[model samples]
Target: MLVSNVYRPMVFGCRADEPLVEVARWMVDNEVGALAVIDGELVTGIITERDLVGALATSDDPASQQAAAYASTQIRTAELEEDAREVARRMLDAGIRHLPVQDRGRVVGMVSMRDLLALETWTA
Candidate 1:
């Protein structure tokens, strides 16, 4: 299966400078575990639930920090046409749960480990 077939088309995101609290709220409201941190039109980083939790635990004022501070700047991406299995392998190697799906350098969607696991169960 291709990443485009399994990835969620809705890419929830926020600006890099946005407050962690606001980003967390957006994640909660959207019921998403990860969010793409954007610098203008470019995807600068990715912030996940784990990152938020870590920030909350370590920071005295989590709300004062920006999403960029907690986000993983070295984003590991999966192309839209890439095989789902390949994407899963990349995610595993990178030790990440989520990946932004790109098509011709533009972010089109997001794929998570959960999504890949669901695909495995469905195929089985």
Candidate 2:
């Protein structure tokens, strides 16, 4: 199956300069695992729940105001044309739940492990 079959366009997103606290709060409020980090018209990075928890775990204060310090700038992405199985495999192998889907260098949609699992033939 193709990613477009299950892609969600209404997913959460944030700018690179957005405060990490805002990102964290968006994840909590939306009950999602990650948010796509947008850089102008490009999909730059992704900040996941795991990233947040990891940052908090190593930090002396979880609620400190240094939000930007906790957000992750490194990200992995997949093309909208890629097969769903490939996306799922990447997510599983990386132990991540979110994959930012880009189309022609623009942020298009996001795919979650949950979305993949709900598919009829997701193996990862």
User: What C-alpha lDDT values do all the predictions have?
Assistant: 0.93, 0.75
- Score candidate 2 by TM-score against the native: 0.79
Q: C-alpha displacement of 121 in model 1, angstroms?
A: 0.6
State TM-scores per candidate.
Answer: 0.95, 0.79
Can you write out model 1's per-residue Cα lDDT over 14-60, one digit (the tens) per residue? 99999999999999998899999999888899999999999999999
The residue pairs that clash in candidate 2, if any, are none
Q: Which candidate is the best by TM-score?
A: 1
> Candidate 1: which stretches are off by over 4 Å?
none
lDDT of 2 at 21: 74
